[model samples]
Target: MSSNLTAHHYGITVADLDRAIEFYRDVLGLDVLDRFAVSGPAFADAVGVDGATGGFAHLDAGSARVELVEYEPEGDDADAGAVNRPGATHLGLAVEDVEAFHEGLPSDIETISDPRTTESGATILFVRDPEGNLIELIEA
Candidate 1:
């Protein structure tokens, strides 16, 4: 590993690229940076999926970047898995007010629970994207 390694973008595989873009951009308020498609031998080798092909979009998440991807010949439509499950991951977003942010979310959005203060004094909550990806919102 390199000594100067820095955090890069986080990638989420989704079933619908367009829908994901709308939700992350319009709902989460992330700015859309770029969108593209990928395929061929290099892509397949990099992702470890044989014959993998997909469409992807890059979004600006303030301090970090989010890459949303949709594979061709779609996979099974299973839940993204619970937060406690092994191999599951979530995207953390910092907000000014967790409660106010929660209230502004769409009525149909799925939230793990109401914002609650942590032992460290930050209020936080988790919400699921349209594709069931967990997103943590925190107010310090």
Candidate 2:
């Protein structure tokens, strides 16, 4: 029998590693799990890039994780237009309170959807990240 393919985290391609780290670590409250440069040829084969450079960091947000991929532009798989892709979708992360999250959202963020009470009583708000990635702030 095959083991279930668990989605451990969402991988994001970043133009700037340090800046992205600051955003996810400082701006957001995600805990940094590990930050270091990847080594060995296995990663290169896995990412389809031979010899990868730059730093990578993993952040733990709730049960899911966020992987920040920073490459030196040699043979990176990530394009700069991750959020701009035609069929790209946002990463929905649940928050304890939507109202707090809504209030926490930066003013510069273009609110996709305002906080609204769902029929189930939960509140939901949609907002875009600095990278223009859509995020659904769901409240329990």
Candidate 3:
């Protein structure tokens, strides 16, 4: 790894682009920067799949970008069963108030855990997105 490397964005594959966009944009308050429909061998090679085609949306999330992709006609619909397991991916979003943020979430969004204070006095909570992806809310 390069010593000067910095994270450009975090990519997530969602089953529904519109729903994910609503959750990340409208609900989470991220701004949609760009959207695209991708296909062909170059994308397949980049993603390490034999064939790749999808709906991609790049959203601005504070200092970082959230890349939401919906691989249509060939994407996997496997349910994310547990967040504790290895290789399970989750996003940690910083908020001003964890409790208030949790309370403001849509009714359809599921709460996985209540707010708990860390050793550093930061409040943290877990919630699941519309497609069952784990999201962590933190307030320092």
Best-matching candidate per lDDT: 1
Q: In what order do the candidates fall by TM-score, top score first?
A: 1, 3, 2
Q: Which stretches of candidate 2 lie over 4 Å from their true place?
A: 74-86, 118-121
Candidate whose TM-score is highest: 1
**Model 2 error, position 9 (Å):** 2.0
Give all TM-scores, in the order shown.
0.92, 0.76, 0.90
How would you encode candidate 3's per-residue C-alpha lDDT over 8-99 as one tens digit per residue? 89998898899999989888899999999999999888888777788999999788899998884665576677887888989989999999
Tell me the number of clashing residue pairs for each predicted model. 0, 0, 0
Candidate 1 residue lDDT tens string, 1-140: 66986667998989989999999998889999999999999998998788999999999987778999999767777667899988889999899999999999999989999999999999999999998999999998
For 16-83, candidate 2 gives per-residue lDDT tens digits of 77877776776567789988887567877777776766578999977779988777654433332445
How high a TM-score does candidate 3 get?
Answer: 0.90
Query: Listing every candidate in turn, what is its Cα RMSD in Å to the true structure after a full C-alpha superposition?
Result: 1.5, 3.4, 1.7
Question: Candidate 1: TM-score?
Answer: 0.92
Supply candidate 1's per-residue lDDT for 10: 91
